[model samples]
Structures are given as C-alpha cells and as structure tokens.
Target: MHADPRDARSVIEQDAMTWRQMLIVLLCVLLNGLDGFDVLSISFASPGIAAEWGVDRAALGIILSIELVGMALGSIALGWAADRVGRVPIMIGSLLVMAAGMSAAALSTGVVMLACIRLVTGIGIGGMLACNNAVVAEVSSLKYRAGAVALMAAGYPFGAIVGGSIASSLLVEGTWRDIFWLGAGMTIAFLPAIILLVPESPEIILRRNSPDRALAKINRTMKRLGHAALDTVVPIARDETGDSSGLFRGAMRRITTLLVIAYFFHMLMFYFVLKWIPKIVVDLGYEPASAGSVLVWANIGGVTGSLLFSYLTTRLPLRGLLIGVFAFSFLALVWFGMNATGLGELKTAAALVGFFANAGVVGLYALVAASYPAHLRAGGTGLVIGLGRGGAAAGPAVAGFLFVGGFGLPLVALMMGVGSLVAAGAIFVLRSPPKAPVRP
Candidate 1:
C-alpha cells in the first residue's frame, strides 16, 4: 500500500514506534547529553581556572552564570526560530555555534574572554534544549512520550557522568583549557550525525507550508519514516509563521505563566547543586580530581533518578509526580548542606541531592513537552526555559555572593532548598493542558 501522509500523527499515536522513530529519540538523547557535558565543563574546570587566575568566588560566580544568560536569550530567540524555520536547522546551527564557542573558550586568555565564550556556547545549548524536547514529543508514540522525554532529559546527567570522569582524569595532568578543547571536539562530532539522521518534524512543515505545499512536504517526511501517505491536507488555524504572543493567549497564558514559574524555582535548586558541587568539594581541601569525582557521584545519582522517574511517569499522574519529586528534592538538598562533612559524606550527600533534584528536572521536561499544542510546542518550551534560566544563572551566582558575604553552608543551602518547595506549590495550582494525552 502507498504510504498515507494525512494519518501520520495517528500512526505515531496508535502504532508501535519504529526503529527510525527510536533512532530519532536516541539522537535527541545524545544531543542533550553533549549539551549536558558542555554546560558542566565549566563546573569541572572552575577549580583550575580559579587557581591559575587567583579569582575569588564573587568573580567566579559571574563567570559561572554568564553562559546561562546567553542560554536564556538563545532559548527565546532560537526556539521561536525553530518553530518558524524548522527544528532541524536550529539544531544543526546550534551545534556549529557551540563548537565555535567551545573552540574560542580553549584559546581564552582572561576571565572576560572565557565568560564571553561560555555565554556563546550556552546560546547553542539553549536552542538545542528547546528544539530537542519538541522533536522527542512529536516523534514518540503517545504511549512512549512521557518515558521518552524522561530518558532524553536523562542524557544531561549521562553526559555529565561520562564527561566528568574524563575531566577528572584530565585535570590531574592538564590545564583547564583542555576541557574546553574536549567540549569543542565533541560538539563538532555531532554536526554530521544531526544532519544525516534528523528530519524536520512533519507538524512544523504543516504549519509553515500551504495546504498543497504542506502535503508534499509532509508526504516526503511520511515516506522517509515509512508511514502511509494522506490523500488531502488540512492546515491548522495558526499562520505559517506562528506568533510568539500566542503563548499568552486565553488559557495558554495561565499555563505558560505557571510553567515558567515552576521551572524558574526548580532550576534555582538544580543548578545550585550542579554548578557548585565541584568547587565546594575543592574548597573542603579535596584535590580538583577528587572534587570532580564527587560531581561524578552526583551525576551517577542523577542518571539513576532520571531513569527511575521515567519509569514512574508511565504509572503516575505527571503533576502529582513532579510535586512529590520537588518536595523530596528540597529535603535532600537541605540534608546535603547540613551533613556533608567528610569525603564519603559529601559523595553520599551529593548523590542524594542529585537523585531528587534531577528527577524533578526530568518531570518538568516531561510536563513542558506535554503542555502545549503542536503549533506552540517549541515556542512555549523555549519561553519557559528562556525565562526560567534566570534562576539557573542565578543559583550558583547567588550562592557565590552569599558565601562571599560570610553565610554558612547550612544557611545558604536552606535558602536554596526553598526554591524547590516553592516550585511544588506552583505545580499544585497548575492544571495540565487539555490537549495533552497524559493523565493530569
């Protein structure tokens, strides 16, 4: 039988996911993992950077956060662009930009140059994050959507686990620049894979092309995916180039607002642990390599938690599940602050914090992926992440300032832990979007 293009979405919903589909999801995971490593590369190298430059916590905080600022802008800009132009283009371009920025970072001579380079790298990452989530959502079967996104989100920690292990080994014999070089090499390596393996999402084509044009394009995609073709095409109500303001329209306005709030607060909790763990361990008189090892323990916990959370997503209500995860995240983080004294204690504490903190992140990504309609998916995700990254950027920087101001670890951790609790409260009020197939 000739492939029918019109029912492509229904095929994705009702049928078993094909290897091609699974490959697309896996690609998203690998891309996200690379992004994970690039973002954390700074954390792993921070000790060496500080030692070589004689930088203080206050300055380092700004350095740590500047890339996140770029990420915010990139998520907003590139995410919108992805919806307009296509996800594949934004993703491919973001990879090249990331490679360039990482390469530049390797050659940076001063704090200013490194911060600027890292910020550029972050712009690439932000675009990738927004686009990758949308791709995973559009490609997966309804039965697999939640678990797939959870697994994709898990890649961040998986990348960190792999990258941190390598960084730990490298820092012993190499300088901080080597880390950026490694990131650059890895970033370049993904460019060809993305170009060859990923096709533009069918929904995006339908949105951007006229009914006749859309049918031709979508049929091409359907053929590529080995799905049946549709006899006719129906365009969605939105314009070819979707409006960003649509995110604030009617019921969507409230959903977007709540998602942004929840994400912002949770990121505060998440990045605080991720960005500070290595430096915190180093400050405790551990070698930089040992500090990196502590962070590996954290990502190991993150991988485990993310995988476990993905499993639970199939059985539980997403909203309730996220709230529960956030609550546990708060308790775990505070525990880490109050009790992490010895090396073993620090490793254990970091692991616990990573488990719950990253689980909360995976849940949020699942919610975001399921929250908006096809036309608005990437844009909505971008706006949420773009603004929420303020908290991500602030988490470490705020902790840095607090430490510089003489606040103890326990007090600072308590303050940071509140972000997750507040996030849980926000989730309590948020209703799942009517369009989402998952249980509310």
Candidate 2:
C-alpha cells in the first residue's frame, strides 16, 4: 500500500531544520539561558540572600531545590500536558509563572517568602525547558534537528555569562534582589516574542482527534514562513494508533533508560563540581575570586561540548558519540578529582569534563527524541527529562551528604565517574526501531 501523504509530510517536517527551525531553536535557547542564569545567580548571591533574610543556610538550600523540584514535576506533568494540551500554551504559561516567581523573589524579605516565590520560578523553569526542548526536537527536519537542539542549547551558557556579569557588577553596588530583577526583566522581553512567533508543534497537533485541524496548523506554519513551495507535505500519523504513553511504549523503554542514565551521571558530576568547586578551590588556598574563576572555565568547557558535539552528532551516530564523550569525561573527572594539584590542573580537567559530559547529556535527549515516531515524541521527550530531572534533583543533595559525611573529592569523583561508565553501558542496549530512519 502507498504510504499516507499526511504521515510522510509530518515526518518530513519534524525531521529537518529550516530557517523557521533556527528561529525556534534560538528562542528556546535564549529562554533556556534565562533559566540557566537564574540557577547560577542563586549560587552567586546565596550568601547575600541568606544574610539579608537572617535565615539559615538550610533554608537557602530549600529555596535552591525549589526550582529543581518544579522541573522534575514540570518535565513529567508538563511533558504529559504538552503532548495532550499543546506545546505553545504550556510554554507561554511557563514564562508567566517564571516571571511571577522571579518578581516575588525580588520583593521577598524573608526566607519562607523567598522559597515560596522560588517554587513558582521552578515551575516556569521546568515547564519551559521540558516543553520547548521537545517542541524544538519534534518540529525540525531530521537532518539538522540534532545540531539545532545543540545550537539552541548554547543560549543556556550565554545566559549564565550574562547573569554572572550582571551579578558581579551589581554586587559591588546593590543587593541580590537586583539579580532577580534582572532575570525578571530578561524573561519579560522574550515573553512578547514567544507570543508572536512560536507556533504549536506540528507533530503534537497531528496526533490529535482532528486531522483537518492538524493539517490546517501545518499550512499555517508553512504560510507564516512564506515558503509553501514544497512538493510534499507531512501528514498526521495517528489519532490513537502508535503510542502516546511515552515511557510505556516498547520502542521507547530502552532509549528512555539509556537517556536517563546518561543524564543522571552527567548531572551528578556537573552539580557536584558546580556546587562545591568554589569552596574546593578556596580550600586549596586560592582567593575567592580566583576560586569562582575555575567554574568559569568549566562552564566554558560545557559550551565547547555543546557546540562541538552538536557538530559531531550530525556527522556521527548519536550513541557512539555519547559513549566516547562520556568515557572521556569519566577519565577527565577521575584525574581532576584525584590528582589536580593546583589551579592550572583543575581548570584543564574541569573544562574537559564539562565538554564531554554536557554534550553527552544533550545528545541523549536528541537520541531519545529520534526513537519515537511523531505521535510519541513529546511524551517521550518529557519522560526522558523527567528521569533526568530526578537524577539532577538528587545530584546536589547527594553531593552535600557525601561532603558532610567527609567524602573526599576523589571518592565523590569516583562515584560520578563510575556513573558515567554505567551510562555508557546503558547506551549500548538502546536501539532505534526498524522503521525509523537513522539520523543523518
């Protein structure tokens, strides 16, 4: 039998990245940057915020965990919702919630109030990231989608740089509230653009009860871009067929397992170092400013991984590249944690770890994304992240426990390094379906 036209067209659309695709990637990346910046800012200003509110550090840690809690909930709940309710509405709602939480943070006088507001901010961060990343992955043409996701990811680090720079300057003359105000301000600017520019994911719409409406959305997306000169159009694949229960699908189980394992190990290493390294550097006798600079180098390493791996992803198999990158990261962390004698060695190791680890994590998302056909992409995306978020949520807390228990840097590093190895093994079991085309 001839293949359905709608299915063919929809698949084609999700598979490639056009100019419009780039715009989506850019917006998602910038929004993600805003998210990343907020996460970093809290760390930078934690002491100041604690002092101003006269709260214990434990209270501040709660405030910090608030967003992560929201993200774990967001990825699972909102990802399910995105597949059901739609991508654009959830994305827009995320920004609004983020704005509310951030504004509340700027206005708070006590730790309880700050944590409450931060809970709202966490919801926004979780929802936006879970939904948008899925949307970006689902809407792109197959050839460029992986790299596009990577390119969009570049926004995250840039936002961190922006937030850090603003914090550094404001700390000299202002309070931590100024940092929240800055975040609220940045998110607000993007809010309007998202409303005007972002359309719903064609894949999600296609899976709905109304194929006619889904096709209309496709035409609208094509018309909005002024490029309707196509010989083929992707059609809606399912109303009930295939699978929507992202994690339960047979095709997804292994991919989901692999992606989550990778995300966990990567986040464990990422957060452990990010949370403690400044203090670690200080313990080694560096000045406070110099200690913070080690992270700066590490963040740069993450950026390098994001960019470089995005390139390699297009040229190489996703699983192979992730394995190699994680292996490299594992070795780098063990070396850095065990034998880094000074600032120079630490910086080198930190960057190398960041490069491989961060990219490996993103590559997992892209890989899981590809395993699902159009109908399940959003659900699959969310489930993978929900698992990752679980790991992420626990990573820092685990690190704190280890640190309080007097675990040495090498011991913690060994745990994360071994985690990476486990993740690499998990990827070996993952396989895309017989029907789905291998990513180019």
Candidate 3:
C-alpha cells in the first residue's frame, strides 16, 4: 500500500526500526565520538603545551577555552544552517573543516597559532554536534528515541576513553603534535563514511524543499529504509512546521529559555571536570601519560553512566530521573574535590564524578530532543548548546583563575558544583513542554 508522505514521521515513530535507521543512529554515535576526542585532545595535550611554551595557568586557561568560543559561533550559525540546508550536508562540511583545522594545529609553531587552529576545529565540532543530535532524534522510533539519543550521547565519553588510551600511549613515545595528527586522520576518515551512508532528514526535506523535490527525496529515503513509497507529497509549509524564530513564541519561549539556562549551568560543570582532570592529575606529581590514564578513567565512568541512564529511561520518568542525576552529580563533583588525594583515590573520584556528570549529560541530550518541535529540533538544540557553551568555556577558565587566586581545590570544586544544582533548579521550574502542532 502507498503510504501518506506526511505520515513519514509517524512511520518513524510507530513502526519497527529498520537497519537503515539503526545505521543512521550508529553513524551519529561515531560523529559524537569524534566530537569527544577533538574537544579533549587539547586537555590531553595541555600539560605538554604549557611545559614547552612556559605558559602560566591563566594563559593556559584561555587556550583551553578559546575553542569553545569558536564552538559557540559554530553552534549558533551552523545549527541554523542545518535547519535551513540539511543535516547531512552541514555535517559533511563540518568534518572537512575539522580535518583541516586539526591538521593545521599539528604544524603550529606558536601558542597563538595553535589556539587559532583549535578555535577553527571547535567550529567544526560544534556544528557536527548540533546536527548529530537532530539526525538521531528524527530517525528513531518513539519507543527507542531516548535510548538511541542516550547511546549517541554515550559516544562522547566512549571517544574520550578510546582517544585517551591511545593518547596516553602516544605521550610515552611521542610529542603532543602526534595527538592532533591522529585526530586529523580520524576526522578525514569519517568524511567518506558520512557521504556514502547518511541521508537528509525527511521531515526537513518536507519542510524546506518544494513538493516535487520533497517527494523524490522522501521516497528515496523511504525506499532505502524498506518502506513503501508514496504517489504524492504534500510539502509542509514553513510556518506550519515551525522554525527557529518560533522558539521564543509565548510558551515555547519560556521552555527554551529555561532549558538553555539548565544546559548552560550543567555544561559549565561538565566541561570543568573534563578539561581539568588531566591537569589536576599532572599537578599531583604524576607523569602526563598517567594523567591521561586518569582522564580515561573519567571517560570510562562517563560511558558507564550514560549507558545506565539509557536503560533507566526505558523504565522511569525522564524528568524526575534527570533531576535526580543532577543532584548526585553535584555531590560527586564536591566529593572528588575533597577526597582525591592519592593517585588511586584520584582515579576513583574522577570515575565517580564522570559517572554522575556524564549521566546528567545524556539526560540533557534526551530532554533537548523531546522538548523542541520537529522542525526546530536542530536549531533549538544548537541554540541551547551554543549558549550553554558559554558555561563550558567559563568553567575551565574560571577554575584556572580561582587556582591562581589561592582558592583550594575543595572550594573551587564546591563553586563549580553549584552549576549542576542551579541546572536542576531550572529543570524543576520548567513544566511539561507543549506538544508540537500537527501538520494539516
């Protein structure tokens, strides 16, 4: 039987998931994994950069956060582009920019040059992340969407785990430049994978393309996914489908604002942990290789937490579960600050912090996916993440200044942990989001 072209979203929501859909989700995971490694590559390499250049902690903090500034720009700009052009196209373009940026970073002669390259790399990573979230959500069955998104979110820590392990080994026998080289090669390798495998979102095609163009594209996607093709296509009006401009409309404006605030606070805490763990370990008198290992342990904990959260979503209410995760995350960060004295203690505490922090991250990913309407999904996610990155950028830089200013680790830890608590409070204030309007 011929299917209603407009019901394509319903098919994705109600029917059994096909391998094509699963492949798309898996690719999203890998892309997110790339984001993980690229973001932390500097973290893994920071000690060497500081040592080689004789840069102070305050300077180093700026270097650590400069890319996040670029990320903010990329997320807002590329995210809006993803909504306008297409998810796959923006993603493919992001990979190219990332590869080039990483390659340039490997050849940098000065701190200024490297920071500039890293900023460029952040632009690619930011755009890629915004697109990946939207693609995974749009393609999954409703029953499995949260789990799938959680799994995709898990890729961040998983990439950190794998990349950290390799980077630790590299640090033993190679200079920090080797790390960027590896990242560049990996980013280049994914270019072909995306081109050959991934497709544009049907919902996006319907909203943005002309009726004839939308029908052909949607049918091609449907055919690949093993679904029946439709004889006619009714293109969704731009106004009917909603857009980024609508994000601030009466009720949605409140949800968008609160969600962005929550994300901003949580990201501030999360990046503080991820960015500083390696440096913190190095300061404790361990070798850089060992420092990388400690960071790896954190990512290991992150993966564990993300997967567990994915499982729990199937059996529990997401809103309550998310708030609970944030509560524990705040405690874990404070505990890590206070009790991680010895190497063994440091590893254990890092893992605990990672567990809660990353789990909360997965929950936030799911929340963003569910909260926005279909058309605004990518843009909304990008807006939240882009602005939230202000916190991510601030976390490391703020901690650095605090360290320079004579604040103890415990006090700084307590201060950063407040981000998660504030995030939880924001989530609590937000009521159930209004459902998206149905297309005629």
What are the lDDT scores of the predictions, listed in order? 0.85, 0.68, 0.85
Worst 10-residue stretch by lDDT in candidate 2?
431-440
Model 3: per-residue Cα lDDT over 303-374, one tens digit each = 999999878876787788889999998999999999868988889999999999998887787787678777
lDDT measured at residue 82 in model 2 versus the true structure, 0 to 100: 74
Give candidate 3 misplaced runs (Cα > 4 Å): 1-7, 237-240, 373-377, 432-440
| Candidate 2 ranges beyond 4 A from true positions | 1-21, 50-63, 110-112, 204-218, 229-235, 239-242, 249-255, 278-292, 314-317, 338-346, 429-440
lDDT of 3: 0.85
lDDT of 1 by residue, 228-295 (tens): 77787666654534466889999989889998999999999899888888889899889999999999
List TM-score per model, in order: 0.93, 0.83, 0.93
Error of 1 at 124 (Å): 0.6
In angstroms, the error of model 1 at 316 is: 3.3
Clash tally, candidates in order: 8, 13, 0
What is the alpha-carbon lDDT of model 1 when measured against the actual structure?
0.85
RMSD of 3: 2.9
